[model samples]
Target: MALRLKSLTLASFLIPSNRNDWDRHLSAKHNRILIVDDHQDICASMRDILDDVGYEVVVTGNANDALEQVDLTPFDVVLLDYQMPDMNGAALLRIIKQKQKAVTAFLITAYAGSTGAQDALNIGATAVLQKPINVVELLGYLADAERA
Candidate 1:
């Protein structure tokens, strides 16, 4: 059920607020990735692609479920949709960081311009990417953590 995406063409992965600060968040053991998105299709598609790449992927369709998972498991990276019915991604990201300050998180949104990428950066997110994401570019961006 993997959907091929071309949104990478938009080049919507905004640059990190600060390169050194972003690199400070990376670590060597970054195999586990948690994806929180209201859209089940997006969750399933990302899980499929990331799973195939040897990542241990866990995905949830809402904020509550994501929080439950966060409380129980330690994830290396978290990808959250900027908007969800239960809670916006920033609030969720803040809570997740409270529980595990070491997790590298990213905000995923279709409305990047309106989603407040700076707020996400201030809340400890590594980056913000628009929807229909380029999994290849995501992998490349995350590669630093893997190689650290």
Candidate 2:
């Protein structure tokens, strides 16, 4: 919850650099977003940034909380952390899909090309975003997801 992100850890994932991106961001108000990460700092940082740009963002530190959020409200997009104590990102995405079939989800992990990370793609992730998220790339995905 401390504002320690400093555009270093989260990087472009929290900053909107392009003008066109801002225009598209207006419509992001309609998009609901969920972030699942065990790291409280990252989750809070992402939530703050995305929420500022008009997204209805919800962040959780564990799978159970993430599941509870999914049950309470439908989200248009999800960012799932690949490594967690109870369950992996792929398994969680599978369960989330069962509840929210149309949600556009991304698997976020430090290991991008690992077998487990690749396995997530088959399960139904829109993309695999490497950790220490890039805000620009994330927004691009959101824009693309919106267009789709």
Candidate 3:
């Protein structure tokens, strides 16, 4: 079965006031995440899941718009879809990495093949996920990223 991230809409959560513990779980400084996919539903779903988890989410449907947004804002992480109409995810990732060497990106796609995964990673994506995405796993990756 494929993973699906269903939770959407951000809400206030009761968190401990302890500075260290809260910082470990989350920061008042929310991480900015950019989602690049041609599918609106996929973009919205990802935004909703990450936003609810205390990330500032931005969504774009095309490579051009994604490039524009990234140029304007600094994103800590980018979620890219492998197949796109104007330009594929690999090409976009190359550009993104060139523009922001420090930004971490993950490629999301239904086509999970050795070649595809390697190509994405070779171009500097932090990881590749097979769709539909599992929210729990994504959070795990984010947690690891926070620690790194």
Candidate 4:
């Protein structure tokens, strides 16, 4: 697969002043994150968001590929979208936890207030984030996960 860069508006997520802040709080080894989302733009946007902040970011448009990436890589954390065409995030998290119990995972979704959040958490998500994720909250979670 080819790795392509997406053009994005950086200001929408990361503040110029805080761009280096994420790196300051966490090292590159502890900052790797895998993002699984069916929407190409969302995946690209998130990849850019984390990448700009100095974290290694990997993204996949489907659950199958995301699973393969997990098996092949050693990501410290994952931010998985709740909805997808092939498989739901909860199912993916279950498989990941079964394969690697120590892996940290978080389910991200617009349906955060719904039962899906509970389902994902019950399955194995270390945490859940409401969609249109708050940057500060996400950074806080990543920082905490880095320490753990």
Candidate 5:
């Protein structure tokens, strides 16, 4: 079955917290992605786009839950929102990198020239994409990630 996750809010799942203990769950055939944003509509739009292209997508509205999901499963790429209530994209990208450095991350933000976007890029984000994303460009990024 095609994996599709939408707006997961529950907590309390456990996986290895350290990268050494975690196993890469994705295979060559599985192109899994995680979408983290506070806005449900944004997540839904991204999910629809990715799912249509046959990617396994999971989305969460909060950073903590996104972290938990990352800990549990290996994702090829992460589309992270730049601003959220609990944490910013840069901070979340740091944690995600710590968990799995191989994962490609893109910071999604309306404020492309802001400090946060620069910070995210500094911390190893693959790219910083403006909000109201262009589906063609986003898919191109995903295609690149899939190749890597």
Candidate 6:
């Protein structure tokens, strides 16, 4: 899939100017989520769904960029693909936890029985979501995360 950029005004998301501003922004109903998947189509589709529902969405195809974004911004939730060429989602979740334990992380995979799925749960993933996720369930998780 080709890489495509979709822009949303930063002001719409209310980019925080300081720590207090960030805290308030996070407490608002409009939360931010990060989608880390190797497939471009998956990222785009997920982003569109979340964006339509009033969440700020950021996506990347690699763990490195995901980690950088995690450091730079506070995400209410992270939807991570379980399989990746560079690193598995479980390992990436560990790194994200180390960086920000407050960020809820979910593993997305077609293979629920895969060791990576078990590892992700063991390493503190909020949940493991099977591929072709139920939009209602996904939104429920996001809502719960936002409330936290």
Q: Of the candidates shown, which would achieve the greatest TM-score relative to the real structure?
A: 2
Local distance difference test values of all predictions, in order: 0.75, 0.78, 0.76, 0.74, 0.76, 0.77
Residue 81 alpha-carbon offset, candidate 4, angstroms: 0.6
Better of 1 and 4 by TM-score: 4
Error of 4 at 72 (Å): 1.1
Off by over 4 Å in 4: 1-23, 26-28
Clash pairs of candidate 6? none
**Mind sharing the TM-score for model 2?**
0.82
Candidates in order, TM-scores: namely 0.77, 0.82, 0.80, 0.80, 0.79, 0.79
RMSD, one per candidate, in order: 9.1, 7.4, 7.2, 8.8, 12.8, 10.8
Clash pairs for candidate 3:
none
Cα lDDT tens digits for candidate 3, 10-112:
2212333465754566655667889999999889888887786688899999999999999999889888898998988888999999999988778888875
Give the TM-score comparing model 3 with the true structure, all chains together.
Answer: 0.80
Clash count, one per candidate: 0, 3, 0, 0, 0, 0
Please give the TM-score that candidate 5 achieves against the real structure: 0.79
Best by lDDT: 2
Model 5 C-alpha lDDT versus the unseen true structure = 0.76
How far is 47's C-alpha from truth in model 2 (Å)? Answer: 0.6
In model 5, which regions exceed 4 Å deviation? 1-30
Q: Which window of 10 residues has the lowest lDDT sum in candidate 3?
A: 4-13
lDDT of model 1 at position 141: 53
lDDT of 1: 0.75
As for model 5, its CA RMSD to the true structure in angstroms is 12.8
